[model samples]
Target: MTAEIVRTIPGAQKRTNDPEGMRKKVLDVAEASFQEKGYHGSSLGDLMAAAGVSGGALHHHFPTKKALGLAVIDERVAEAVAKTWIGPVLAAASARDGVRLVFEAAADELEKQGFVRGCPLNNLAHELSLADPDFRAALARIFRAWREAIAEKVRADQQNGGEKGIDPERFAALVIATYSGAMSMAKTAQEATVLRQCLAALPVSGQPAA
Candidate 1:
């Protein structure tokens, strides 16, 4: 069909030469699929359909399913962790306050959604870590970055005379562990109560004013 004829066809899309736009569109669909159904569970044909891309277009950006999965982890999941956890902690008055606020916000968001899908990173880690070495490394890096961001916040809070006598790195790990477990429990229960309970029992202490 001619270009003009293609444009006039109902329900037909006009192809663009915008590679970056296409890549981002695929990434958005792939990330959501990976988060909802898992990497192993989201098949390529289904992904292509959901992404509104042909096999050639999908492979042009990601040569394999593993490549797509890695991109989702390195790009999409990392961005989410940065926005949801890291940014809030760094901007909060103290590490304790930062973590508390994150928990509260997460609980509220999950309740509103009404279905607990669990943490994207946590969900992917459990499913992919044991299945592939590259996947493990990609996921490990995100977890490390997340842990370090929290640890850095804790260190800053301590220097300001809060979170006294606590090991920043260890405390950071504890915070992640608590959230991971709470999210898992909440996913199973299909509720956010475990998250609220865990948040209430968070160990780190902050300034009274905070």
Candidate 2:
């Protein structure tokens, strides 16, 4: 089932008997479990229990754990990147400000949530990159897409003579790497200060007044 289908169904929890509902519920719970605990650390039994679905139900939909993980990556995780990063960056008035705003909003969220967990993509990348090629490829695609989104904005900024000094590709790579590292540090320390410090150090020039 598509993430769009999962999202459109109201009262999903109350419709467990329906095939689509069961599938959506399983994906929802599995994504949360995988995010909280590493993929290998999260077992099918735990997922079934958390999702309030029987083993038969889960098997009927996913058939195997790997299939479920891939679905979460392709659907939920991809959708998250689109909603949180790509869409906002595309819509903002200035690409540089768009990138900064994303980090600033992330810092605020980290502070509000007490910085318990790091970025979902970063967490999965660390855990699964060496374990499975499929997982690694899926994650790499997301990372490339994210970097390209930012790079496109940087290129636009450069063309407009806003961010003229740096190479757009290099700058985009730096932004993603720095943000990921800062999130890891924040997760380790259980503090948001690391993110704020990183954001503060970001280069900005010719930025229009907000």
Candidate 3:
């Protein structure tokens, strides 16, 4: 289920009244509203209403619906974006552990957010990718970052005694693609189990040569 709306926490900024904080609040509301109602379907009034802001406030922050959507994508990239592979990849003392931990952590994060498997990058890409070149490029950057971050972690593992004599890059791709597919399924089913199963299916690496 989508999270229940509450007063903006203002953690990202000093005050709820701050311009940046208020802008983020607008994006947060827009994301939920967009998820409920697609970009083409959702009216500016809907986002404004969800944010509990006047047209003046929304315009002051985002002058147009496309601008608001862009802000939403930016916020997703900076925070609350669901490529959880980063944390576990860094946590691993070993390469094999890094692979498992990264995928599993991804699953755990998805479940924690409850039923929403909304990856902001994927959400916008699936919708506006063909229509808007700018939107497509913005989301593509995040997607690239997500993959590169995992790839870097695996590369780091090689020097750190993470695993001995294995193809770290290929393994990174497997883990990333695995989690991405799992997240997509979870998004479709609206269930966390899909993610849990995907991670669980990952082969435990670092095994003795068979």
Best by TM-score: 1
Q: Looking at model 2, which ten-residue stretch has the lowest summed lDDT?
A: 201-210
Writing each residue's lDDT as its tens digit, candidate 1 over 41-79 gives: 899999889978999989988998889989999999999
After superposing candidate 3, which stretches have Cα over 4 Å from the reference? Answer: 1-21, 95-99, 105-114, 165-168, 205-210
TM-score of model 2 relative to the true fold?
0.86
In terms of lDDT, which candidate is stronger, 1 or 3?
Answer: 1
RMSD of 1: 7.2
Model 3 root-mean-square deviation = 9.4
Query: On lDDT, who's better, 1 or 2?
Result: 1
The 0-to-1 C-alpha lDDT of every candidate, in the order given, reads 0.89, 0.83, 0.69
Q: Count the backbone clashes (under 3 Å) in each candidate.
A: 0, 0, 1
Task: Give the CA lDDT, 0 to 100, for residue 200 in model 1.
Answer: 70
Backbone clash pairs for candidate 1 read: none
- Sum up the clashes in candidate 1: 0
Candidate that scores best on lDDT: 1
- Give the Cα-based TM-score of candidate 1 against the true structure: 0.88
How many angstroms is residue 193 displaced in model 1 relative to the true structure, after the best TM-score fit? 0.7
What is candidate 2's lDDT per residue for 1-210, written digit by digit as tens?
554545555654455457567788898998888888878999999998888889998998898888998899989888888898889887887776777888888988877877468888888888888988999999999999999998888888777777667787898888889889998888889898887677777774343322
